[model samples]
Target: MYTFKFIPRENIAQIIPFLQILDVNIPAETLEQRLNEMFDNNYKCVGAYHEDRLIGVSGLWILTKYYIGRHIEPDNVIIHPDYRSRNVGDQMVDWIHAYGKANGCVASELNCYTGNTRGQKFWSSQGYEIKAFHYRKMLDNEL
Candidate 1:
């Protein structure tokens, strides 16, 4: 059996290695910036651990608009590769969804890369849909 907890910032260092294992693209500076912004914006971070070892991390942001009262985005969700296929990911998603709902979120949105078919399938299984296709372009430094 596994245990979970919402680790405080003082305990964040213990999870650095776990985050590295997940290979998430968030850089330290970016992470720090987001942490500060989230504090200012009232966003929150929740994590999961097993036997006192960090196993999963998720970042959530709440959005409010004139047309939409409140919405949420599961910006990042990562589980150690070794722990995949054991329903940890699904449980994480469910927890995030429930957290969002309880915090006044009317809906949640997430985007998975086209190449990540497994993730696409998982989200689909969780009842998310292909709302739209996103496009991005990188400009030359000279431009």
Candidate 2:
């Protein structure tokens, strides 16, 4: 049986390994700091657990944007590779939607990498529509 719960600050260390599986290039040392900063803002995270182990995670950013009005932006959704195709992702997404609605969000939004067709399909199946293109330019050196 899998249990879902809001992950707290002290327990964040337990999520590092699972997050690394989503983006292996992320520096483990810096991730905690960044996550802490985000948590201080409007960022929220939920985790799916099988007993004491984390098996899936999702993040949400509560924001008020001009175009979307007040909405919940879901990000960094990842399920353990071993647990794919078992509707775990769907359940996590469903939880996100319900959470957003309960919080009075007008809508839910997210961005997926253009090359991730599988992710795109999954989001589409969850009733998310493609509304805009997300472009990014790294500012690490310029800043």
Model 2 per-residue lDDT tens digits across residues 63-119 = 889988888887888889988898888888778878888988999899998988999
Give the runs in model 2 whose Cα sits over 4 Å from its true position: none
Q: Per-candidate RMSD vs. true structure? A: 3.6, 1.8
Clashes of each: 0, 0
Model 2 local distance difference test score = 0.84
lDDT of 1 by residue, 99-126 (tens): 8899899988876777878878888988
Which parts of model 1 have CA positions greater than 4 angstroms off? 12-40, 66-69, 136-143
**TM-score for each candidate, following the candidate numbering:** 0.74, 0.91
Best by TM-score: 2
